[model samples]
Target: MKSKVIQKIKLTKDPISNFDLVIQAQKGVDAEMAFEISETLLMPDEDLSLILHLSTKTLKNYQKSEKSLNPIASEQVLKLNELRKKGEQVFGSVEAFNNWLKKPAIGLDDAIPYQFLQTSGGMDLVMEELDSIAYGDFS
Candidate 1:
């Protein structure tokens, strides 16, 4: 009789703010079998309205298609492709571009957040960060 291996793993990180909780998990029996998990435990009824509003907005965006995507978003996708091509020319592969695209758009909180005005700040911040990196100004 052969014995099977059982492995378990857990990971966790503190929330960015005192208002929330963050937890993560990973498990695997071998290199071939693995799983990951993440959890954000929100306070009971803590700004439930805001959470629902944000969720609804995200669902709407996720439902959007190439045809339904706003002009700006469509343009952004095109720009991303262009940048991807440039990266391929320099790096010899589009792996970097594909990796970037595969990332969840969570950092675009301002663009995705529900409020028209409040979200702009976040988007602006993200754009500024991108610009700084693009201009070779790491400071």
Candidate 2:
């Protein structure tokens, strides 16, 4: 029974957002897979930092929160709203917003750093695929 449970857990994918960050940070998931996943989860003009921060918060809550309806969920939602406000303040003008959008998806080497990629065995596969795509191996 224990082995069966473990196997089921192993087969399950980690939350899609974590996979996105691992690929983005490592520059290593397959382009198609990454693009598809990103498209599904992110709006075309979404701020990478905003999505990343939200994903990080969501993943943290999923792992640690008592349940979906816990106070932590509300707190995270509030924090995200606060972050959006800060983003607007920092990138007040349309030009600033455009420039920010044009910037590389992963600005800092540690923006969506390696430490966050250590979720499980599957992450390495995600990294490998991302690396290949970044190198134009897909074509």
Candidate 3:
């Protein structure tokens, strides 16, 4: 039997299907991927750095060397991706979700959801609020 060359894949194309892609991620996200995520979220470099708990110099070093993120940072990236997917699901569009993120939400104590996206637990709370929105139980 001829040996088949299996190509490495991105694990999951959609966040809904593979919500724990971060846990499965071995190589983690690369610098290029990081940059793309930042662009997708419209996050400034400083904010990205804060969320990843990385210093500006460390980020610069990664970019300068074109390295993959550490597991912690990779996990954060996955969390962000999950939040993004959930946001789109709730708002019907990414643009709409982004706009909603900028506006204060009554469910979240009138805090902008975007401001709390810096951590996984915070994102989880945001997702919970989104759930409330979906169920028309905004309390």
Q: State the lDDT at 51 in candidate 3.
A: 86
RMSD of each: 17.7, 16.6, 5.0
lDDT of 1 by residue, 1-139 (tens): 0003111211212112212101111111121111111011111222221322333344244434211223333222222223333334433455543343334334443232212212334334434434544566432
Among all candidates shown, the one with the greatest TM-score: 3
Candidate lDDT scores, in order, read: 0.28, 0.32, 0.71
19-137 per-residue lDDT for model 2 (tens digits): 43333334222222222233432324133223334353444444354223223222222222222233334446434433433343342331332232223332343344334434554
Q: Rank by lDDT, descending?
A: 3, 2, 1
Poorest lDDT segment (10 consecutive residues) of candidate 3? 1-10
What is the RMSD, in Å, between candidate 3 and the native fold over all Cα? 5.0
Task: Candidate 2: list runs displaced more than 4 Å.
Answer: 1-69, 93-107, 110-139
Better of 1 and 3 by lDDT: 3
Candidate 3 residue-wise lDDT at 57: 82
Put the candidates in TM-score order, highest first: 3, 1, 2
RMSD of 1: 17.7
* Tens-digit lDDT string for candidate 3 (36-99): 6677778888988998898878987887887778877877766777677777877788788888
